[model samples]
Each structure stands twice: as structure tokens, then as C-alpha cells.
Target: MPFPLYLLAMAVFAMGTSEFMLAGLLPDIASGLDITVGTAGMLTPAFAIGMIVGAPLVAALARNWPSRSSLLGFILVFSAAHAVGAMTTSFPVLFATRVVAALANAGFLAVALTTAATLVSPDKKGRALAVLLSGTTVATIAGVPGGSVLGTLLGWRATFWAVAALCLPAALGILKGIPAGRVKEEATGGPALRTELAQLTRPRLLLVMLLGALVNAATFGSFTFLAPVVTDTAGLGELWISVALVLFGAGSFVGVTVAGRLSDQRPALVLAVGGPLLLIGWPALAILADKPVALLCLVFVQGALSFALGSTLITRVLYEAAEAPTMAGSYATAALNVGAAVGPLIAATTLSTTVGDLGPLWASGLLVAVALLIALPLRAVIAAGRSTEVLP
Candidate 1:
């Protein structure tokens, strides 16, 4: 791996840790702020909303900036937000910090994708993107769990401090590793925001973005409820939640790695084989809800299948929206975050019915079914995209 790529991955790990670690810290934060956990929960959605809305907006505004400066600026803001959040006693202040951090994170992800793509050969772009994305999966496996432990051992505030502390090395690395210069687009004053928006309007681009969103909805939908599923449905202890988290994270890390290796060569074919497997996996998860060992194993399978689909779709988004590299990443970032925001609401609706703990799994299955239906027609487009051949 290039040294610069390592720096990008480290930065992503810090950003990913900051975003996902909030779930574990919510209880402590709520108590400290003298608010209900439910209210504290709003911080997560606020961050999601920031990602959804800020990705395109920030990507466009920073389109003319040097990638190095843009990346470094994003890191500075993210670090400051966490630092402020750590010291704040007010819930609203903390909430604001979450949104600020998310906006910075959203920009970093969008820009990082384009940056990573440029750092490698055309054939190797998929692998490079995967390298950047792997940081997030590793975060799931290590960072989130570590943050939870850190919070438990120290206090939630210390986790915030640790996240901020991670930024120093990453910032230093960025300054040293990434070449300092403006891109061709920046020298040419970049396309108008309208041009970037036009790229998003292309049907092929929209299709890929939607596919990314739907897959994530399925992923986060089921994932959001894993703890309840473990304890309530599977009749396991709280320890099982940690086990499930690790299994799912590990499987996703492996899956993304597999997708990266095959993406440039056989994206559509992977979708064909993996999509049905994913569709089938969900119902099994629901049916085996009461069987602890079975359910836990299936959780790993679900994670692999879903992330394989997700990572492939994201790579496709890059090809489909090749006209606007940075904005393409923004569209991908916004699409995934949109799914993350919407999935739980869909699953939450099912809880009022007889489904109970099965709701999330069944809801995820439905989302996957829809994604397949959408994906079925787009395999040709995905294949066409490889050669810059857009089907009519």
C-alpha cells in the first residue's frame, strides 16, 4: 500500500470510530446531560441527516480546493467538534457537534473516494477504494468495540478525547504523504455546481446510487436490532451482543475485501450470485431467531452478503458517475447514509405488529428483495460501465 493510502485509512478509522462509537456512549452522555436516552438518541440521526444533506453540498463547495488542503481542513473540523463535544455539558451543544462532525466526515468520505481513485491505476481503482472503505469495517471490528470498552473503563468523554487524539497522527501523515497541489479541475475552476448536479441526474448514476442505498437499508435495518435480537429473540445474555457485533464486523471486513478483489473484473456477476444468497439469508435469520448459535452464525453470513453487495454497488457508482469524480463519491456517501437513516424507521414500524424481534430481519429481507429487483435490470449497465459504454 502507498504511504498516502495508509494515511487516508487512518483518518477514515478515526472518523468511523467517532461516528459509530456514539451508540455505546449514548447512555453515559444522556445521564451526564440530564436527558433521556431517547433524546440522546436523536444525535445519531442528526449526524445521519448531516451526512445525507451535507455530502453533496460540501463536495460541491470544496470542488475547487486542493485535495490535500480539503482533506486536512476536514480533519481539523472533525477534531474540533469532538473536542468541543467532549467538554460540553449541554445536550444541544453535543447534538450540534455531532452534526458538525458528520458534515466533516461526509466531506472526507466523498473526497477520499476520489483521492483514492486518483492514487492508483484504472484497473486498481476498485482495490484502492476498498482499502479506504476497509478502514470503516475495521472500525466496526475494533474501533467501536474499543470505544465501548474505553467508555466503560473511563468515561464517555474520554472516548471523545481519544477520537480527537487519533487525528493528530492522521493530520501529520496527510501533510507529509499527500502531494500538495491543486487538481486539474481546481485549476480550471471546476464545473459549476449545476454540472455536478447534472451528473447525478443521469439515469445510470441514479440507479447505482439507489442500489447502494437499498443495500445499506437492509444492512443497517437488521444490524440496528442485533442486540435486541440476541437478548430477546435468541434468549442470550448481553455478552452475546458483543459476540454478534464481532461476527458481523468480521464477516463484513472479509466480504469487502472479496468485493474489492473481484469488483473491477466481475461486479455484475457477483451481484447475480450474491444477491439471491443475501435474499435467502435474511429469512433464515428470522426463522432461526430463537436458536442462539444458529442466529449468531447467520448474522455473520448476513454481514458478508450485504457488504459484498454494498461495496460492489459503491464501486459501480464511481464508474457510472465518472463525469464528476468527487461528486460521484458524494452521491455514494449520501445514498448509503440515506439508507442508514431510513432502514430503522421501516423496521421500527414492524414492531407494533406480531413480528417483534423478527421485524428487523423481515424488513431487511424486503429491502434486499427490492434491491434485487432493481439490480436485476442493471447488470448490463454495470458491465457496460467498465468500458465507458452506457447503454441506451
Candidate 2:
């Protein structure tokens, strides 16, 4: 764990905060821009679209550049975008800024993950990714809620200014901490774009991407509707929403910590533990929605299980496609966002068409079950391969 890793974590925290803070400030933004909340809510997915589009594009463009320089440039652009966003009043300008910020975020994360991975040994990649993703869970815990309060007290624009301020220290640290010429110029062009794309089509890489997506779909699908389920179904009222969310965040933090420690030696085993937790947690969540305490407890467990997949997914992809590390990581990021997109759509559709308030829970549980079915066989293969080597 070099100091640069922690600095990268700080950089990730700043970007992660901007990514999620919009969710909490959508109401204020809607009123300020004179748009409906639903229209304002579209900013979240717009950002995701930018992320999906940006990662590979940035990797191609910056293929020759050093990771430290690329990281600094992206965060600088990200900070400036937020600064302009703080001054903008029109909805279109704000939305454009969101997309711009998201593009910067995507590029930064793709580089950061690969850079962090390369800095450590093969076995330590799990911990490296966990260090980086911990920032995201921390944002869920602190940044989103804090930004919401800031927007309520000051204005939505104030939150943007605050986010801009957060980026400054990270940019400075990247400049000072990450040594120049640290990352090797990537293996001097062995493959063309067509070949690289063809390589990425391998079944193992695809499975890893699908695993990333499914795990996230399960986590976020159910979470998107948690407020309604807690308040309406459990009769817990609005205040409990905040408490439940905090508990969820706390559980997420714990999960990442524990998973980081174990995933290096037992990556597949971590997934084995995590997948079943969702299987048990979700049905319990649906059944116990009538009991506030039980619902809250299950939410915590589900949150932990959901996020515990983060390191395992990334580590698995890294090993599966070691030859194309940057693209592999970018693909994983895109895949996880794909799941993020899918989860919400499934939950929203289930609520509108079929299931009622409990729809998301049931839908998410089924998704986790499918992901587990995928994981079980994959885990068996991984274990078999390892056993063959060990016995030989």
C-alpha cells in the first residue's frame, strides 16, 4: 500500500461523490431549473451513458500517455466542469456539465484501477480495487447525504461548488505523489483494435462482465425502491429511511473491508459466500417488510452482500484478461454500469406493470439467484483449475 494508492482513493472519493450527489439533489435541481423531478432524474443515467462511452474512448486516446498525467488531466477537467455547473442556471447547461463530469470520471477510474493494479503484485489486485471502491461506498454513506443537506440549506449550486472544492486536493496529490514514468508504456502495441476487440469476445471475459452486471443489478434494483418499501409497506415513516440507508452504508463499508482481506487468496470463495447471502437476504426482505426492525436488519445484510462483490468481480476480470488489462478494467466498469441501468429498469417496470411495491425485492432476488447459478459453475471451474495445479 503505497501513499499514491491512498491518494488515488481520495481522487476516487471526489469523483464518486459527484456521481452520487446528484441523486440526493435532484429535487432542488428540478425546482431551480423549472423542470419536473423525473426530467432532472434523467441526469443520473445520462452520466452513466457518458461513463459507458468514455472509458474505452479514453483508453484508446491515452494509450501512449502516462497514468499519472492522464489522471491529473481528467480530474482537472472534472473540477472545472463542476465549477461551471455551479454558475449555470439553465437546465441544458447543467445537464451538459453532468455529462462532461461523468466522462472525466470514467476516464479517471479506468486509468486508476489499472494503474493501481499494476503497482501491486498479482495477488494484491483485489485489495487495490477494494481500496479504490471503498470511496464509492463512502460516498453513499457521507457524500450523497451531505450534499443533499447542503442543497437544502444553501442551494443546489452550492453543492456543485463544494464538489469542485473536493477535487482540488486530489488533483494536487496526484501531481505530487505519483512518481513520473512509473507505469510502463503498455507493451509496445502487440494487437490492433480489431484484434483487441476480438480478444475481448472470449467467453471467460464475457462471463466476468456478466457477473459484474448481475451482481450490481441485484444490489441497486432492490435499493432503488427501498424508501417506498420501508415507509409504505413497513409503516416506518420517512425518518427511518435515513437510518436504514446509514445502516446499509455501514454494512457496505464492513463488507468491502472483509472482502478485500480474503479476496486475494480466495477470490472465488468470496463470491461463493456473497451470492448466497443475497439469496437469503432478499426473500427475507420481501417477507419481513411488515416488520421495520427486521427490514432494517435485512437491508444491512443485503447491502453488505451487494457491495462485497465489487473486489471479486474486478479481480476476476483482471486475471481472466491479464493481457488486456486496461480494456478489461474499462469493460468491467461499463458492465457494472450496465447492471446499474438494468436493475432500475427492471424494478421500475415490475412496479408499474406487475408486482406492486414489493416488486423490486422479488425482481432483484430472482436476478441474484441467476447470478449465483452463473457463479456456482464458474467457481467450480476455478477451483478445479487450482486443484489440478496444486495436485501436480
Candidate 3:
């Protein structure tokens, strides 16, 4: 509830809008560049790949910088990239800008998490993170659709310009609000940075990240094509697609808030409940696709449970990597992006096959079940560790 927290959320909202608004702008971009829609679609993966590769590297490179400086620098670069993108007429130029923008996004997100965690008491970390992540959910509900409509009315380039303009205020917020110093690292003495990076290979940590990735894939697999699925299978008009999106976003907002409060005390329980909910929701969605009301209800439930699991997953990862918060945040960002990249690919393949639009629901369900299987063992792992030492 601090002013700086709002600034952090604003930066995330800008980054998230840039990240997701592309989904709506793809056809326009394709037409503008005289490229195929499939080619334009490649920009999404390019951005994801940039995030996956950039976050850890940026965290390592900026390890010694003040958090405020790092945040401001990253967001400035993000704005610059979007400005360049707004002027480019070539597909390659636009694609390259997306990569650059995503790299900046990764850096900003990593620094923001580290900054948020540092600003608040250990007991409040989950709540702070939830506040930051709400930006993304809001962007999904408002920014994406708004960008699409703006592009339709003005131009796709105008949307990029608008995003670029938005970033200036975010950067200014970071400068004015965030403390101008490095975050104090937790004192859990390790060998060195080399040894710390090696902690990434730990079985427990890797398992948590894997769970994060799988959860994302399960959610995004069906979510990527929600517009078409709602209309074609749910038997709804185009108007209802936007309504469904807002409902899902509202549910996500609620889920993150609740998960944040419970995560510090009952993270495992939250994950346990969320994973099964997704597994059940997706399959039920597949069966009830023709029932408009049922489909709407399931979509909201699925979104809520997905974010509940996601926020808890993030809390656990931060706890697991308490010694190296920046890189831990980076790893979390990369893991989510990996799932974001893979989920749509799998969903698209399903949409092309005989199974039709309903295939994504089943695919997402199977992925969630696999994630649950992997996560089930984590409870025992946490219990054994807790028996030895208390976790934050």
C-alpha cells in the first residue's frame, strides 16, 4: 500500500501491455509489413525467448546497481524500444524491437520483484508481489482490448507510441518514489556468485520452477484462443468474448489477493487446491463448451485458480532462493516465459487438428495434471526441510 508499490505496478502494467497487446495487433502488423500473419505471430515467441534469456543475465549484470537505477534504466530502454518500433516499417525491424523491449521487460520485472521484496517486511512479501502482478491481470482485461481497438481506429503503430508514452510516467515514478539504494541481501553466506548460480540446479528449486512453467502452459494453452473458443464452441456472440475476458481478469485479481494473504502461511495448500481446480475446470470446460453460462463460470474459476497457484509458486521460489533474490526473481520470470512460449504453440497445433477448438481444453487439463504430479512431491520436500529449519 506504499506509493512506490503503485509505481512498480504501473511499470509492470506498461510492460505487460506491450507483451500481450501484440496478440491483438498481429493482423494489423502483418498487413502493414506485407508479411503473413504467421510471420507476425513469430514476434510473440521472439519476445518470450528474449525474456527467458535476458532476465537472469540482466540480474547478474546489474547485481551491484542500485535498485532505483536499475529499474529506471530498464524501463527507459523499454520505452525507447517501443518508440523505435512505432517508426519501423519493416517486419524484421519490428521483430527486433520486440526482442529489445522484452529484454528490458525482463530486467524491469526482475528488479521490481527484488525491490518490492526488499522494501517490505518478510511477512509482507507475498502481498507486495500480488499488488505488482495485478498490473498484468488488469492489462489483460483492459490494455489488450484497448490496444486492439485503438489500433483498429488509429493504427497499430499508434498503440506502440501510446505504450512508449506510458513508460515515461512509470520511469518517473521509479525515480521519485523508490529508494535510491541497493536492496539489502539476506545474510545466508554462500561460496560466491558461481556457487549461488549453481543453486539453480538443486532438485527442489528446479521442481518449483518446473511447476511454475507447467501451470503457465496449462492456463495459456486454452487462454490464447479464448475469443474463438467462446464464440465457436460456447455459442456466444463476439460481444461476450470481451465480457468473458473481463470476468476472467476479475477472478484473477481476486485470486492473487487471496493467495498473497495465505501464501506465507499455507503455500503448499494453496498450490494443492489450485492445481486440482485447473485440472477439473479445463475438462469441464471441454464438456460444457456449448453451455454459455457454464463456459463463463468455468473461465472465471480457471483464471482464479491459475493465479492462486502462480502467486504461491512465486512465493515458494523466493523462499527457496532467499540468498539470491535477484536471480531467483529472474529465474521465475524465465520459467513463466518458457511456459508462455510453449503453451500457445501446443494450443495452435490442437486447434488445427480434428479435435477442433475443444482440444485446447483437454490439452490444458493434461498439462495441469502433470504439474500437479510434479508438485505433489514438493509437500514432502518442504516438510522434511521444515523439520530441520524454519522457512520464511
Give the best candidate by TM-score: 1
TM-score for all models, in order of appearance: 0.96, 0.93, 0.94
Query: By summed lDDT, which 10 consecutive residues of candidate 2 come out lowest?
Result: 383-392
Cα-based lDDT for every prediction = 0.85, 0.79, 0.82
Per-residue lDDT tens digits for candidate 3, residues 1-392, read: 67898899998988988898886788898999999999999998999999989989888887667788889999999999999999998888888999999899998888788778777777677788898998888887788778878998999999999999989998898899998755535234323567669879787778778888888888778888888878998778987887888788778888888988877766667866777777899899899989999999988888899888887777666666676765778877877888888888888888878879988888888888888776675575542222124333
Over 1-392, each residue of candidate 1 has an lDDT whose tens digit, in order, gives 56698799999999988877877888998898999999998998899899999888898888778899999999999999999999999888999999999999999888888888788876666788778888888888888889999998999999999999998899999999999973525625556667778987688888888888998999988887788889998899987787888889888888888988888778867788889999999999999989988998998888888888898888888877777865877888998899989998888898777988799899999999998887676678865535345566
lDDT by residue for model 2 over 1-392, one digit each (tens)? Answer: 77888898888888877887776688888998899999999898888889888877876676557888999999999999999999988889989998999888888887887788888877787787788888888877777778877888999899999989999999999999988887524546545545555657787778777887887887778877788987899998777876777777777877887887777777667777777877888888998999988998888888888888755776666666566755656776777778877888888888875558898998888988888788776675432222112111
Indicate the worst ten consecutive residues by lDDT in candidate 3. Answer: 383-392
Give the true-structure RMSD of model 3.
2.4
- Largest lDDT belongs to which candidate? 1
Q: Which stretches of candidate 1 lie over 4 Å from their true place?
A: 182-184, 187-190, 385-392
Q: Which pairs of residues clash in candidate 3, taking residues 3 or more apart in a chain or in different chains?
A: none
